[model samples]
Target: MGWLKMPLREGVAALQNSIVSELQRNWPALVTLTPDLLGLEYPGETTLDFLEAIRDLTDSGMVTCEAIIISSNDGPRMVDAALTARGRAMFEPKGRAAA
Candidate 1:
């Protein structure tokens, strides 16, 4: 059987979409980024990849990183993330009344 493959851009897009969807569902609440949690969400992605994606989103002002959790050894561990106004505007569907 031939192996199925996705282009790099498409894979990245899917990851981004998953992140946006999670944030949309947890709107107004910060989502903690842990390796295990990320793994559960995007099984194919590595922790470093997720971090890079989060960094890209932050750079674009699509999301905000509240805090960077560090280990006692002074290494970065996880990040606390939340969607920004711009992110919400882009991800949230239009013409929906706020409950």
Candidate 2:
């Protein structure tokens, strides 16, 4: 059980890292937070998993989400997000590393 849990945790962490890195690379673009959009950005990741990663990023304050009503049938939902200052800093080259 413990071994199974370890792999699962590692996989999730990897997915999260991938999502963050992709967002950082695509900085300044208003990325839709939907599973389909994320899947397009990161294929091989299930919609549920991508949604979970987006939730984690939002909770961590690394991104800002905006609610939008897409249609009459659909209610207002968090549809788009953009990286925050902290997230942008992630890609900044370090003092010596930049040289």
Candidate 3:
């Protein structure tokens, strides 16, 4: 998929902002890909992209995501903040078949 490219450092920040919190733990429960259940347009894709980008930050002690969850007051929304070795973050959408 076409993604907005940036830098590794930015990817790290993006992942942290998207998943990591001030829990002060070595590992996280899971990436917990946030989703809008109401079904928006690109929120889910944007969130999943970050989840896929996890490959980029794995070496940096970043946490990995498990199952993706979708939820939205108005529409289902899920966004990924996974990091990519290409030194950037991306939005990896779930398979269209599942949609």
Candidate 4:
């Protein structure tokens, strides 16, 4: 399925995976979510949809967004976002100490 066309759970999972991957690549640095980083055009998705996906990550103790600004034109702007240890674990190879 397309990025935004997936079921809500799967879409959120995909979004989380993307966020984790980018954060993992940068390691010690944080990210500010941009359209380029997000890399998807959620045509039918709303700001709440974006926020809900992000909320899922934060609620699961996976990642953190220091500043989440709701843009009137855009959606949510996730500033200074970073993965937690748990989020990093998602990228670990199988059999590695991911927990």
Kindly list the per-residue Cα lDDT of model 2 for residues 37-65, writing each as its tens digit: 43433233454455556666666677776
Model 4 stretches astray by more than 4 angstroms: 1-10, 46-48, 95-99
lDDT of 2: 0.55
| Residue range 1-99, candidate 4, lDDT tens digits | 644533565466677677777877786888887544677664446444567777777877888878887765765678998888877776676787754
Reference-based TM-score, model 3: 0.29
Q: What TM-score should be assigned to candidate 2?
A: 0.54
Instruction: State the lDDT of candidate 3 residue by residue for 16-87, as single tens digits.
Output: 444433211212221233322212244545454443444444435343333334445522222333333222
Clashes of 2: 0
* Overall lDDT per candidate, in order of appearance: 0.65, 0.55, 0.36, 0.71
Ranking by lDDT: 4, 1, 2, 3
- Expressed as tens digits, the lDDT of each residue in 2-76 for candidate 1 is 655433443556667778887778887778765455444333345446656666677678988767664534334
Q: What ranking emerges by TM-score with the best candidate at the front?
A: 4, 1, 2, 3
For candidate 2, the 10 contiguous residues with the lowest summed lDDT are 1-10
**Predicted structure 4: lDDT:** 0.71
After superposition, the stretches of candidate 1 with alpha carbons farther than 4 Å from their true spots are 1-10, 40-45, 69-78, 97-99
Residue 4 Cα positional deviation in candidate 4, in Å, after optimal superposition: 24
lDDT (Cα, 0-100) at 23 in candidate 1? 75
Q: What TM-scores do the predictions have? A: 0.65, 0.54, 0.29, 0.71
